[model samples]
Target: MTRALILFAHGARAATWAAPFERLRELTQARVPGVPVSLAFLELMEPRLPERVAELAAQGVTAVTVVPVFLGQGGHLLRDLPLIVEQLRLDHPGMAISVSGAVGEDPSVLAAMTDFCVAQL
Candidate 1:
């Protein structure tokens, strides 16, 4: 089955805020190879999650895994994301869509972040 990974992030007004996320998409795409990896923002940005997923669904991507890049499971993650997912599911009846936990909460990711913080000490 065709699959895609969407790295979802909270968009900011400053263009520089997107630099790291773009680098992340590039790095992830290089590592996964073949499976398309893309970046989508929630707000204050272009190509929101729905638009990106629509493009993927149209491209015949049967399954999509969305990784939230947010650091905390706040209102946007706890409330808005689920509503968005539900709507997207209805919008793309055939495609399998799944949302993963916030990247900052992943054990490995948290450890890495801790390392970076420790290094600053």
Candidate 2:
């Protein structure tokens, strides 16, 4: 089964806010050569989660792993995401969809951010 990774983030009105996410997608895509890696926004951006997932499903991707790039488990993660995922599941029943925790909650990511902050001192 073909699998893909979708880096999910809360989009901003400023177009430049997506630069980092786009870069993250590129870096991730490079790590997993064959697996499709993409970026999807929550709002104020194009290719929302459902749209991206549908594209993947159309491409015959049977599995999708969504990684929320948010900094914490806020309302967006607590409520919005579940609802969106529910619809995505219904929309693409043949595809297996799973979601990972917020990237900021990961110890490794937190450590990296800590390191950057420390360097600033």
Best by TM-score: 2
Model 1 alpha-carbon drift over 4 Å, by segment:
none
Residue 88, model 1: lDDT of 97
What is candidate 2's lDDT per residue for 1-121, written digit by digit as tens? 9999999999999999999999999999989999989999999998899999989998999999999999999999999999999999998899999999999999999999999999998
The per-candidate count of clashes, in order, stands at 0, 0
Which residue pairs collide in model 1, if any?
A: none
The C-alpha stretches of model 2 lying farther than 4 A from their native spots are: none
Q: Candidate 1 on 59-118: residue-level lDDT in tens?
A: 999999999999999999999999999999999999999999999899999999999999
lDDT of 2 at 72: 98
Listed per candidate, the RMSD to the true structure in angstroms reads 0.8, 0.6
How high is each candidate's TM-score?
Answer: 0.97, 0.98
lDDT for 42 in candidate 1 is: 95
Q: What TM-score should be assigned to candidate 2?
A: 0.98
